[model samples]
Target: MTEEKGSMLQSVIHPTAIIDPQAKIGPNVKIGPYAVIGPNVTIGEGTEIMSHVTIDGWTTIGEYCRFFPCASIGSEPQDLKFTGEKSFVIIGDRSIFREYVTVSRATGEGEETRIGNDCLFQASTHIAHNCIVGNNVIMSNCAGLAGHVIVEDRVVIGGIAGVHQFVKLGRNCMIGGLAKVVQDIPPFVIADGQPARCVGLNSVGLSRAGVSEEVRRELKKAFRLLYRSGLNLRQAIAEMEQELDSSEEVEHFLRFLRNADRGICRGTKE
Candidate 1:
C-alpha cells in the first residue's frame, strides 16, 4: 500500500493485542491489551481501541474515534435472514463508543449500518442491524435500537429505552428513560411512557441547539395542533397549513408527520 492509503505502524500497540497485517490502521492510533482487530476492518487516524475491544467485518471507522473496553463493532447482523452477505458498517468521525457497546453490520449484501459524526454511545448500548444513526445523537447506557431503526440528528435516547424495529426517532427529539418506543417520534418533541406518547416539545433541547424563540413558538403551535387538539392527523395537518406560519423547523415537523407510515406516537394511550 502507498503512503496515502497504507497502514501506519502504531507507536503504542500492546503485545497482547492481535491485529491482522492486512487491516488498515491509520497513523497515531493506539491499540490496548487484548484488543482484536480483524483484516476486513479499516480504522481511521488517531483512533484508540481500549482493552478487550473487538473490531471486525467490513467496518470503516472515522478519524479520532474512541472505543472503550469490550466494545464490539462490525459483527454480522443478529437477523435470522442474514446469509453471510457482504455488508458494511460505516461510522463517522469523533464518535465515542462506551464499554460493551455493540454495533452490528447490515443484513443484506451491499447494505450498510451507518452512523454519523460526533455521536456519543454510552455503555451497553446496542445499535441493531441496518440502523441509520445521524450526527450528534446520544444514546444513554443500556439503550437499544432494534433492526432498521433510523435515528435522526441530535436525538437523545434515554437509558434503557427500547426502540422498536423500523421506528424513526426524528431529529432533536428526546426519548425518556425506560420508554418503549413502538411508533415514529416526530421531530423536536419529548416522548415518554409505555409505547411512548408525545409529552411535549423538546423546548430545552431546541434552546440549547440555538433555535430562535420565534421558531419555537411556531413549533409549539404545531405541537398543539398535532397533540393537544382533538383533530386526527389529517385534520391537524390541514390546520397547520392554514393557521400556523412557516419556518424550516415547522416544515421539517410537517414533513416528518407526512411520512408517518408506522404512525406517529400519540399524546395519550387509548
Candidate 2:
C-alpha cells in the first residue's frame, strides 16, 4: 500500500478518508480512516493524521508531525466578531498533538496563529486564535490558552492550567497544575496559585536548559532585587541595571521586564 514519487514516496491514504482535491499532502504522509483534510490545508512530509482527525481552513503543518485521533486543527476562531475573513494556522516541524487537541485559526484577515518546532500538546489542549507559541514548549492535558497569548520557548504549562487572553509566558518558565494565569510571566521563573504568582526561579528548568551557574546567580540576585527589596518596579529595574554585570541573561531579563504591559506576576511575601 505504497506509492513512490520522484525522490519521496507518496502518502498512504485510507479509503475511508476524505481529502479535498486542492489539499497539498507531502511525501510519506499517512492519513488514517475517516480523517478529513480540507481544501486549503497543507500537510508536510512524513506527518501522520490519525483517524477522525479534521484539518480544515488555511493551515500549514510541518514535517514529521503526529496528529492523534479526534484532533481538530485550523478551525475558524471562536470570536463572535469574526466575519469569516481568511486567516491561517502555521505549525512547525516535529510537533506532537494528542487526542482531541484543538487549534483555532486567526480572527483577522491574513493573520496567522503560529507554533514553533518540537512542541508537545497533550490531550484536550486548546490553543485559541492568533496565539504565538515558541519552540520546545510543552502543554499538559486540558491546558487552555486564550486568544493572542504568547508562549515562549521551553515553557512547561502543567495540566488543567488556564492562561488568560493577551498574557505572555516567557521562556523556561513553569506554571503549576490548575493555575489561573492572568498576567505576564517573565522568563526563568516558577508561577502558581489562583492568580499565578511567582514563587521562585525555575532552577530545574534553567539547569536542564544549560544556563550557566554564573548567570543563575545573577538572576537570583536580580529576582531578590525585584521582589524582596521592597522597591518599586522602576526602582528595581534601575538598580539591577546599575548593580548587575551585563550578561546576556541579565539583559534579556531586564528587556522582558521593560516590555511587559500587563505587568509581571508578583512574588509571595516571605
Clashes of each: 0, 0
Model 2 over residues 1-270: C-alpha lDDT tens digits? Answer: 345354335788888888887888899999988999999999999999999999999999999999999999999999997899999999999999999999999999999999999999999999999999999999999999999999999999999999999999988999999999999999899999999989999999999999999999999998898878998889999999999988888898899999998998998863
lDDT of 2 at 257: 93
lDDT of each residue in 164-254, candidate 1, tens digit only: 9999999999999999999999999999999789999999999999999999999999999898888999999999999888988889999
lDDT of each structure? 0.93, 0.93
Each candidate structure's TM-score, on Cα atoms with residue i matched to residue i, is 0.96, 0.97
In model 1, pairs of residues that clash are: none
User: lDDT of model 1 at residue 118?
Assistant: 98
| lDDT (Cα, 0-100) at 136 in candidate 2 | 100
What is every candidate's alpha-carbon RMSD to the true fold? 2.7, 1.6
Query: Which numbered prediction scores highest in TM-score against the true structure?
Result: 2
